[model samples]
Target: MNTSPTNSDSDTLRVLAQAIAKLILRFRFSRSRFLTLLDEELVLQAKNNDPQANNVTLSIRTGINRRYIPQLLSGEAMHSKPERLKMILEDLKWTSQKHYQSGKVPLKGSFNTFETICELRASGTLTYKAILEELMKQGKVKVAGNKVEIISNNSEQDNEHREFARNSVEKVFYTVEEIIQTEKN
Candidate 1:
C-alpha cells in the first residue's frame, strides 16, 4: 500500500478539517467531546485497516487514551453501535461483490457469509448478532428459514441520515473549493 500522501490527499485533508471545524462551530460542540469522537473514529479506522490493531497500537497511532480504547470499541463510550453496523455493511457489500455469485447469498456453508465478513472486518470487536440486529432494524437484510438475503448495503439510508451525510461531505468539498480559489487569487 502506498503510504505517501499525494497532493490530492493533502487537499482532501485540509477540506475535511475545515468542514469539521465548521460543524464544530455550528453545533458549539465541546472540545473534549469532539476529541473523544475523533478518537473513536480513528480507532475504528485503524482496526479496520489492521485486524491485529489493539489498544496500544491505536494509542500510538492516534494519540488517544489507551484506557478508553476498550470503552470505545465496546460501545460504552459514545454508543457506536450504528457506526459499527455501518462498517459491517460496507464490508459485506465489498465481500459480496468479490465473492458472491448473485444478489443473494447463503448465510451458512459459505466462507463469505455475513457472519464471516463481520468477523473478518470487525476483528472480534463487533459481534455478528449485533450487526445482524442493526441491519434487520434498518431493513437492510432479511433472514428466511435458513438463508439470509441482503436487501441493501445500507448505502441508501433514511432521508434524514442520507441528507446529513451528504451535507457533511458537501461542506468539505465547498470548503476545499473556496480554499483553492483563495489561493489562486
Candidate 2:
C-alpha cells in the first residue's frame, strides 16, 4: 500500500490538528487524558464495526498499546470514565471532600455547603446558587430538606459525562470523515 500525503493533505491535517489542540487546551486536558480519550474513541469505533475486534488489531490501527486497548474497550470503561464534562463535577467533588468533612452538608450555609463551596470555586462573575442549580440539574447533587448531598462516589454523573464525551468524539470523527470524503471528491 502506497500512502503519501500531498501538500494539500498535510495542510488540511495541520489545520485539523491545531483545531483539536485548541479544544484540548481550552479543556485543560493532560496528555495522558487526551491519549486515553483517543484510545476510547478508537476502541468504540472498532466495537461498532466488529464485536469481536481484538486488542492486537486495535493497538496496531490506533498505535495504542495492546494492554491499554482492552481497558479502553472494556464493558465498564466507556460508562465509568468521565470525559469532557469533568470541571464542574470535579469542583463539586473537591468541595465535598475538603469542606463537608462528613458526607453531607447544609444546603445553604455561610461555610461548608453549596454556597461556600461555590463561592470559593466559582469565578467572581458566577454565583453559588447558579452552580448549585447546575449541579442539581446535572444530577451530581441532591437537595433534601435543608441539606445538599454530593454524589462523590463513582456515580451517574460519570456515566453521563462519558456518554457526552463519546457522542462528541463520534461527531468529530463523522465530520473528519466527511472532510476526507470531500477531499477525495
Each prediction's TM-score against the native? 0.39, 0.43
- CA shift of 175, model 1, Å: 27
Worst 10 residues of 1 by lDDT: 77-86
lDDT per residue (tens digit) for residues 1-185 in model 2 = 65678888799989888867865664345555676677798877977788777878777677777877767777345333444235545655666667667556676767666676556655586776776776677666778788777665575866776677667757877898898898789
Residues 1-185 of candidate 1 have per-residue lDDT tens digits of: 77789998798788678877876655434456667677778888888888798789988777778988887777575643345566666776676667775555456654878778777767668777787876787678888755567785454556656578568757766877897788789
Per-candidate Cα lDDT values, in order, are 0.71, 0.68
Cα RMSDs, all models: 15.3, 8.9
Cα lDDT of candidate 2 equals: 0.68
Which residue pairs collide, candidate 1? none
